[model samples]
Target: MALDKQDLLFAGLMGSKAVNLIQNANIVNNELINRVLPVIPFLPVKNEKNNVTSKSGHAINAEDNWTTRDSIEDQKQFFPLSFSFKENGQKWLFPYEPMINIASGNSIVKRNVAKQGDKLIGTIKERWSRKDFDITVTGVLIGSIMQGKPEDCFPREHFSKLFEFLKHSKEIFIYCHPLDLISVNKVVVEDYSFPFTKGENVQAYELKLTSDYSYELLIKDDF
Candidate 1:
C-alpha cells in the first residue's frame, strides 16, 4: 500500500517526542524563601497518585443512615515531574523517565456511621488530612561526580546539596511541572547509598518529605 504525504505527517505527529523540562526547585531557609536548588539537571520522575485507601459497604442498605458508610481518601490529581537544568548553553534532557520514583502523597477523608440492630444510623463526620511523600532516586546521574560532563549526568557538588539539606533540615518546594509544585515543609534524608564501579558512579537515595499546607496551580502565562 502506498502512503500519502498527509498520512506520513499524521503518523509523525502522533509519535512526536514530548519533553518536560524542569525549571527550578523552590526552597526556604531561615529568612531565605524560594531558594532554587544549586544543582539542576534533568531527572526522570513520573508524577502520579498512589492508590487510595478507603472502606466501603459496612451495611447492605444504601439509603439507611447506618447503610454502607465508607471513609474515602485520595490525593489530589497531580503529576510528578523529572528535573532538568541547563549549563554552558547546552540543553540536558533525561533519557529515562522512571529513574526517579516518587511514592504518592496521600490524603484521607474520615466518615462516621452508627448502626443499631442491623439498621445503621449515624451522623456523618467529615475531616481531611494530607500525608507525606517517600521518594527514591536512583540513576547514573545521581552518583556521577565527573566534572565537565553535562550530558546525561550531574556533578558531585550538585549532589552535595542533598546532604546539606539533611543537615540544615531546610524545607523545599519542588517544581515538578510547570503547572504545579510539590511544596514540602520538611525534607528528611531517609537513606543514602551507592556503589562504586569501574569508571562509573551510581547512587541511590531515599527521602521522606512533609506535605505543604496549601498551593496554587498557576499557568505559565500567569506565572
Candidate 2:
C-alpha cells in the first residue's frame, strides 16, 4: 500500500514494525501490552514472504481492530511504562513501570587555596571526562490481574531475561524519555535485585545502572 499520514503515524508509534501493522491482532487483547486507543495503519501489499499472515491476518487494508501500545503512546501516564531500552534491534517492553530516576553530575575540584590581601581564593580544576550518570527503574509485573493467561502474563520469564542482562558483562543500548533527556544511550547494570512485594502473582524489580560512553575520534583528518 502507498504511504499516507495514517501509515506515518503508525510508524511513529510502532517503529519499523508498523509495516506489518499488528501481527497477531487475532490474539486476545489482554495478551498484548498495548492496551490503549486504537490507531490505524496502511499495510504493504501482501507478497509471498508475507504470506505471512500473523497480525490481524488481513493484509489488504488498514484495520481499526488494532490498538496503540501503552509504552509507545505516552510516558506521562507512568502507570505502565512501555519498552524503554533495546539491544540488537529488540526493545524490552515494560508492563507497568512505576518510577524511573536519573541522576547526572561531574566531579570538579578546588585546590591551591591561598590567602591574599585579606581574601581567600582557590583554583578549580576539571578533567576531560564524560558526566557520571546513575539510573534506577522500578516496575511491577502482574500475571494475576486476569489480563492474560499465566503463561503469557507471568513475570518469571521477565525476571529471567532481566537477570540475563544483569549478568551480561557488556554494555547494552538503553533509551527512554528520561534517558533521552540526558543523552544516555548505553548503560552498565551495576546491580539488580528483586524487592519485597505483596502480590501472589505480582513481582517488583529494582535495577541500578551507571552510564557507559565510548569516546571516538569525532574529528578525523580528511586526506
Candidate 3:
C-alpha cells in the first residue's frame, strides 16, 4: 500500500524515539551493573552466630574487612583476611590473618576423692564445675616481606594493636573459623606474648584467651 509523505515522516520520527529510549535504557542498565558489581563482592559474609559464648545474639559482621596494603583492584579481592574482631562499634581486622595453631580446653572440676576415712565405695562425684573454655592461639602477623610486598619488615603496628587488646582487658567479639565451628564468639585476652622468631616480615605471637560470658548487674537506686 502506498503511504503519504506525512505518514512516512511520522514513522521515521517514532523509530528515532524508540532508538533513543533503547539507548537510554542501556545506559541505565550499565550504570546499575557497575554499582551492583562492587557491592556483590562486599555483600557480607555468612551469618554464623550459633557459637557466640559472650552474649545471646551477638553479631559478627565479616564484611567489615580491609587490606593494609594497596594493590590492584583485581588483587584486592584476593588479599588475605581471616580474623575479625568487633566490639561497641569498633572493629579490628587482621589484613593477612593466619592462625598457625589453635588449642582449646574446657576449665572443669571433677571431685573424685572422698575423705580418707569415708567408705571405700566408688568415689563420690559430689562436686562438678565446668567453667569457660581456654583458647590458645598461635597467630602470625603477616607483613610486606611475606607477600613479597615492598618492604621486608615486621608488622609492628599490628603487633602493638594486638597487645593493646590484651592490656585493655575488655571482652571482645571475635570471629574465627576454627573457633566459630565450636560456637565460640566472645573472648577475653588473659595473656599474650611475642615469641622470638627469625622472620623479617612476620612475627609469631601466642595468646591465652578465655571464653567470655557477658552479664548485666542491676544497681540500687541512688538519690
CA error at residue 158 for candidate 3, angstroms: 1.9
In model 3, the Cα lDDT at residue 27 comes to 46
List the candidate numbers ranked by TM-score, top first.
2, 3, 1
Q: Whole-model Cα lDDT per candidate?
A: 0.33, 0.52, 0.48
lDDT of 2 by residue, 38-130 (tens): 222224333444212222222322232222222233453433433334554676656454456778776666466555444545463645444
Model 1 per-residue lDDT tens digits across residues 1-223 = 4445533432232222111111111112211111211122122232234222222232322222111101111122123223322112222222222124556654656566645445656544476555666665443223322212333233354346445554544344343442244543223455654433222222333344433344568746754
TM-score: model 2 vs. ground truth:
0.54
Which structure among the candidates has the greatest TM-score?
2
What C-alpha root-mean-square deviation, in Å, does candidate 2 show against the real structure?
15.5
27: Cα error in model 3, Å: 54
Which residue segments of model 1 deviate by more than 4 Å? 1-115, 121-126, 142-155, 178-200, 214-223
After TM-score superposition, the amount by which residue 204's alpha carbon in candidate 2 deviates from its true location, in angstroms, is 1.4
The CA lDDT at 193 in model 3 is 71
Question: Each candidate's TM vs. the true structure?
Answer: 0.34, 0.54, 0.47
lDDT of 2 at 207: 81
